[model samples]
Structure formats: structure tokens, C-alpha cells
Target chain A: MTSQTKAEQTGAAGWTRRRFIITLGAASAAAAGLTALPGGAAWSAEDAKTVEEEIKRLMGGKELADGAKIISMDLPQIAENGNTVPLEVSVESPMTEADHVTTVHIVADGNPRPGVASFHFSPLSGRAQASTRMRLAKTQNVIAIAEMSDGKAYMTKAEVKVTIGGCGG
Target chain B: MAKPKPRIRAPKKASKGEVIEIKTLISHPMESGQRKDRKTGEIIPRKIINAFTCTYNGQEVFKADFHPAISANPYMSFFVKVKESGEFEFTWVDDDGTTYSKKSKLTVN
Candidate 1:
């Protein structure tokens, strides 16, 4: 078995802004070797508008403050069954009475019931870790929202391929 | 059929400094409300395990809040860092006001 390099484990996201600057400085010392690679920034030229519209419909068309770097979503790279797929979400924030995960919402673009579920949390909740299996009618991207106690909204997503039907099968 | 009693697996005892592993599974129909029963020809209202919580030695180690997106017969595996040996109690509650509970013991070295 091969151990994953630390860089690989972090994915394209593992690099924070401060880390990027440090890496850039190191690359500058090596004669143009440190060029910044393209990042998965959440900038939308077109599709972003559509996603925003969908979000407004779901949230009463209120402007949603963007959330970055606070929420993480995990799922199987490939689901064995389209019917029942497992999903887990975690947010790196203290569940303090003053600052905790307020709510978590999971949505999918392809499912019949797109708004899969919404969980309301409070500071009494020692932590924000959710694990559950879902029914995916087909292959689609699953999205998760973590609303922190501080009124900040963070979003993360995963792509899953549903293999077999779970609800009817 | 009435819901079966929740099945919990445990050693009934554990010890200190050793991280204790716990597994929990609850028998739930986890109806998504989108499916129709073949025999009754009626819409199944959403009845799922909405959340799960674990308390060790009276302190909560983990908690999860769920949505309709979660599948049926929810099964979750997680661990708690054991500093002292005590009974770990787990409870899973459904939206229908049903509660399933199990307790395990641990001994500290």
C-alpha cells in the first residue's frame, strides 16, 4: 500500500492564502519555478447565477453571504448504489454557546426532492459532525451548508454516482 | 410492523487512556415521503432517524443532526477518546418521537 503524500491529501484546497504567499516566495528564489497553479475558486461567470437563483428560491430569495474555507463535505468517490449513498459533513468551528453551527442543509440538482434535508443546531451541540446515507435517484452533485452561530454561511459539495435504487428497490 | 428495538454492540466494559470505539445501528423505515407503498397505494410520509447523540461518562462525545436525504436503517461508526473508564450511553431519536438507547461500559487502566 502506498501512503498518500501530504500534498495529495490536502487536495487543491489544502493551500491557504498565507501558504500560497510562502510558496510563491520560495518559488521566486528558484528562478520562476514557483508559478501559481489554477485554483478551484468559486467564481462563476454564468452557472453561478443559476445556482444563486435556485438558492434564492430555497431561502426565500434573500442574498446569501458566501462561505469559504469553513465547511467540508465528504462522500464516496463512486457510490455502489444510486439508491443509498453515505454522506458526511463537518465544520471546523467551535460549537460554543456563542458560536456554533446553526443549521446544515443538503441539496442536489438532479434529485426529485432537491432539498434533501435541513438540520438545525445549537451551541448545546458539542460538535458539528453529521453522517448519514442518502437516496440518489441518479448521478448528481450533493451540496451541504453549514450556518455557523456567528451568522456565517459555508457551503461544500460532493459528486456521487448512484448504483442501485434504494427507495423503491 | 412495529419498529424493532435498537441493536447496540458493546464490550459492556472498557479502560482509561485507550480510545474506545463505538458502533450503533437503529432499525428505521427512513421513509423519504417520495416513495409509494406497493400494497397500500399510499404516499409514505417522511419518517427517518433525524439525529443521533452519544454521551460518555455523562459528557457528550458526538452528535449528528440529519435530514430526509439520509438513507434508511442508519448505521454510524465513530470513536470517543477515553480518559477514564465509565459507561458510554448512546441515544438515537427519530422525528416521530421514538427513542432508541444502548449503554456500554469501559474500565480505565
Candidate 2:
């Protein structure tokens, strides 16, 4: 939270620039490591473009803004096996019929298909948290978007590096 | 047809209006169609659990739509509010149109 505020204080000079550089550096390093394995090049080349396209498709062409405060995604920085990447998603909501999360979408940019899963919820759920095991083809950002009942969307993303490809090798 | 084993874990009892955790696991290969046979080199047909749903006391609690990216023997955990004594109906739909289901009873005090 403090760092995010500091980033905001920089007004796109310090925070966004630093975050962008860090993300780019990490992505390149991870991509290099992934491409070293058999059939890794094909997976490493999948950039954030696919993830954006997927979010667009899932949103039905709806627009999305940064949801740093509303959604939280839990994933490992490095996955020993790509076949069973554990994921957990949680959203801030009251779980009341008046204002509750309606759906949560999961997407992996490097997978053969961008759409990984979508979870629906209601007031009966009591909370908007979901955990499951997912297969990852390579190093990529796994995105989670939560749709609220009042026609609003929030999202968060995490990157997972796969040592061994999960889908096929 | 052989039955697919679906298992669930939840509190046998809970206080009314208390939030509790629910866990589910189903035994499945969850074969994604992207693989090839080691010998014949033919594309393996995809067979995965595509959806999962849970209902409590006849009221829908939570639901999820999965894809080939889901691992074999898919396992998931979520939360629910227990209002009354009833059962949780857990269901999983596979790519082959197979619906595997199981139920667990809960007592709310």
C-alpha cells in the first residue's frame, strides 16, 4: 500500500516507470529461462497482448480499470510443475444482495487458450474467494477479474514461472 | 458406467450464519487435447472437467467454469454461509458430457 501510494506520488515518472522496468526485466529473465527447455520458445513469445485480448473477450468488449484495491490474486513466483499451479482469488465485497460479486474470471496468457476458468457467486456464498489448481504452459501472467452485481469489474494479476510445461511437452 | 469418485470436505456442524470453508476434490485424468501419444504420435483427445457447482439446502452457493488448463484430479476450495441444517450438493461436468456428483450433510445449530 505504501509503495503504491509512493508510485502515485511520482505522477507516472517514478512509480509507473520503475514498475514497468521491473516487470519487463522479470518477464525477460523468466522468458529466457522458459525458452531454454524443449518447446519453450513457442510459449515464451506470448506477450501481454494475448492477456488483454482475453480480458476484452471475457468482458464482452467492456472496459476495465486498475483494480489494485478490490481484487487480490495469490500465486507462486515460480512453479516447480506447471500441471498443478495452485491459485487463489479474493475480492472485497459485503456479500450482500445489494452489492456482491457476480463472477470471477481466470485467464493464463501463455496457455493454449486464454480462458482458464470463470466463477460465479451470490449472496449465499458469504465471500468472494476461490481456490483451485490450474495447468500452465509456461511463464505467464494469470489474471483474475471480479464482476460485481452492480455492473462493475475489478481485476488483479500474478506471474507464475513453470519449470516444466504442464499442458504438453 | 463406472462412477467418478467425487469427494468433499466441510464442517459436519456449524453455527447459524457462520462462514465456513468447503473443499472438493474429484479423481479425473483431465486430459487436455493438446498432447500426443508417445508411440503413435496422435493428438490425445481432450477430456477435462469443464464446470463445477455447489448448492446448499437447495440454494445455489457457488459455481465455476473450468477449462483444459485445469489440472487432473481438480481440487477447489471456497467459502459458504451456513444458515440451516441441510446438504451440500457438489457436481462436476466433464468434457465428455459426464456429470459426477456427491453430497455431504451439514448440521447448523
Candidate 3:
């Protein structure tokens, strides 16, 4: 109205620009939210304890005795890859019906789920041993618990240091 | 759909009452459902081998339950006590309801 053509033209275009900026901001915010979810939840120390507690509860809340010699866990001291780590567990026992290893529970305390896998054995198995590859979310303890037919439980723990790719921050 | 190929390495011969080892590996990507597509930025649905079982002479010898944290090309090894000549069957169940299986024969002398 006062011969201010340039200012008036800019004011009209500024509204559209503001809306565009707002839309872009919202889109980025949504992407951020998605990234914050699911896999982003790192395995924290508290989570490790929770995993141990859950395993204990599954074991009837009874503490597992340290199996210094009976149980052997074969895993690398330093895992170069966090995604694929080979593990082996062997229990020295006579595969007899009277005295045999019943089950072995594998737990990676640092993974999202503590209990990785469980191996069951019968006298027909002749040996209590298993090998498998698993993903480790982070640096944590890998535990193996072997339950015998005589109602005795033994456990061993090994720490694996995960060295490569994790949540790409 | 192209089926997954399962491979097994087990000795064909063993002494009677001998403990033998069996190894198995399957071809699978094992998408953890926790990943996102790099280009589309979309979450990839989780798919994995959820379970594995081995039976000898129609009797269960070994079994395992797997989570998403298992490796891509899932590999497992277990021991078995061979009693006589029998067939060993290995089975793997995927998350998508696909079952991949293979068989091997063992002759215990």
C-alpha cells in the first residue's frame, strides 16, 4: 500500500518457505525417532544383571556352583566380529543313564537376550558337548551352565571382547 | 521360492558304542528384524532359523532353540553315540515357517 513492493513480495514467499522448513524439520525428527528405537537399545550393565536374574529364576532361583574343572567353555578371548562368534561347551561326564549331563544352557550376558541356546543330552548322546556360532551385542560374559542327572548344576563364565562394528553412532 | 540349502558333515563310519560328532550349517541371511534398509530407511523384518533338531533311528538325539542373535549362516555341532547302523536326520525351522532338512547315514561296526 505504501509503494513497498519488494517487502510485500518477500512476505508472501516467506510463508511458503517457513512451511517447507517446518515439513523438513518434522521429517528429520521422525527419522531420528526411528533410529532411537529397537536396535539402538544397547546392552547396558543393568541389562546384564537382569539377564542373570532371569536365568536364575529359570533355574528355580538356585545359585549355580562354579564349575572350575567340570565345564569347559571354548571361546575366543577377543572376538574380532560382534556378529559371529564361535563357541563350544563341553562337560566331562560319563554318558550313563545313572550319571549323565542332562542340559547345558548358553548365555551371553551382553546380548539383548541373555539365554542364547540350550543343549539337551541323553545317555544315547554319549557325550555332553556342543558347538555353535552366535552374535554378541557387546563386550560381555558368556556363561555355560550344565545340569546333571544327579541334581547337580555347574556353571562357567568367559569374557569376550567384541571389537568391531556396533550401533553406528 | 528358492529353498535354503542345508549341509552336514558327519562321519559315515564309526565303531560300535563310539561317540561321533556331527556338524551342520545352513544358508540364511538371518535378518534380525532390527536392521534398516540403507537406501529406503525402512526397518527390515526379522527372519532367522528359530530351531534345530537331530534324530537318529527315529529317536531325538539333539535339539536347540535359537534367537535372532544367532549368526547369519547358522552352524551347529553336537555329539552322538552311535549304537548301530542307522539314519540321522537333521531339521531346521525358519522364522517364516520354512523347514530345511537333510539326512545322513552312520554305520557303527
Q: Which candidate has the top score in DockQ?
A: 3
Give residue B43's lDDT in candidate 2 (0 to 100): 47
Worst 10 residues of 3 chain A by lDDT: A17-26
| Residue lDDT tens for model 2, B6-87 | 9998999999999999999999988776665544434456677889999988888999988778888999999998888999
Better of 2 and 3 by lDDT: 2
Q: Where in model 2 is the C-alpha error above 4 Å? A: A1-49, B1-3
- Residue A101, candidate 3: how far off, in angstroms? 1.3
lDDT of 2 by residue, A41-64 (tens): 232122223666767777877767
lDDT by residue (A80-129, candidate 3, tens digit) is: 98778999999999979999999888887766456577788889889999
In terms of docking quality, how is candidate 2 classified? acceptable
Give each model a TM-score.
0.60, 0.81, 0.79
TM-score, cand. 3 vs. native: 0.79
Q: Looking at candidate 3, what is the lDDT of residue B100?
A: 89
RMSD of each: 20.9, 16.2, 12.6
- iRMSD, all candidates: 15.6, 9.0, 5.0
Please state the error at residue A25 of candidate 2 in Å. Answer: 30
Candidate 3 chain B weakest ten by summed lDDT:
B34-43
Error of 2 at B10 (Å): 0.7
- Chain A TM-score (model 3): 0.69
